[model samples]
Target: MDKNEKSKPSYNQDIIKIIQARYGYSQDYIRKSIRGDRTGIICIMIKDEYIRLNNEALKVIESQLYKL
Candidate 1:
């Protein structure tokens, strides 16, 4: 299938919970950030840092985010 037609990965709740537990970030904050909502400055910073450290993770997250 073409890139546009390819099925995107859905949000993995287990991964989300793991991230939340490890980073101590609230689920609401993460969800909002993924949805491109304006979150706290710290939340944005943490998200950026996470993306920087894990490029593959960012891809999954972005895929899920865009699916929302």
Candidate 2:
């Protein structure tokens, strides 16, 4: 799979809103930042958060697989 495009179990507004609420940024700005449409300390922070959430989701999936 492409590094840029994540597979299923993707993120949604709930996760985005979590970051927005925590960091005090607009949902549009956070979405742009995650999409690599912008750059800056704030953008970097947003991207990092997105990656963190993605990884967390992956771990949950992995654990479910192991339960089989």
Candidate 3:
């Protein structure tokens, strides 16, 4: 990713922690799932959550930029 871009939204962050807790999975597994190393329901759910959170965060950043 470019330096100006945020890091991956699902790694070493509260978002992953929260999801891990809810799904009873390890952080590493979650990361792997997000990185597309794994598959199945959990992977699908995590991918969806990651995308939703990432988009929500971007929208917030965009609105803040517009206000400034």
Leading candidate by lDDT: 2
Model 3: which residue pairs collide? none
Question: TM-scores of the models, in the given order?
Answer: 0.42, 0.70, 0.68
lDDT of 1 at 59: 85
Identify the runs in model 3 with alpha carbons over 4 angstroms from their true place. Answer: 1-12
Give the per-residue lDDT digits (tens) of candidate 3, residues 45-65: 997897777678779889999
TM-score of 3: 0.68
Candidate 2 C-alpha lDDT tens digits along 1-68: 66797564345777898898899989888888998889999899899988898788779989999999
Q: So what's the TM-score on candidate 2?
A: 0.70
Alpha carbon lDDT at 56, candidate 1: 71
Return the candidate ranking by TM-score, descending.
2, 3, 1
lDDT of 1 at 37: 78
Give all candidates' CA lDDT scores.
Answer: 0.67, 0.85, 0.80
Per-residue alpha-carbon lDDT of model 1 for 1-68, expressed as tens digits? 66667664355466557668877878877656655575677668656754554677778889999999
After superposition, which runs of candidate 2 have C-alpha atoms over 4 Å from their true positions? 1-10
Rank candidates by lDDT, best first. 2, 3, 1
State which candidate, 2 or 3, has the greater lDDT: 2
Output the worst ten-in-a-row residue range by lDDT, candidate 3: 5-14
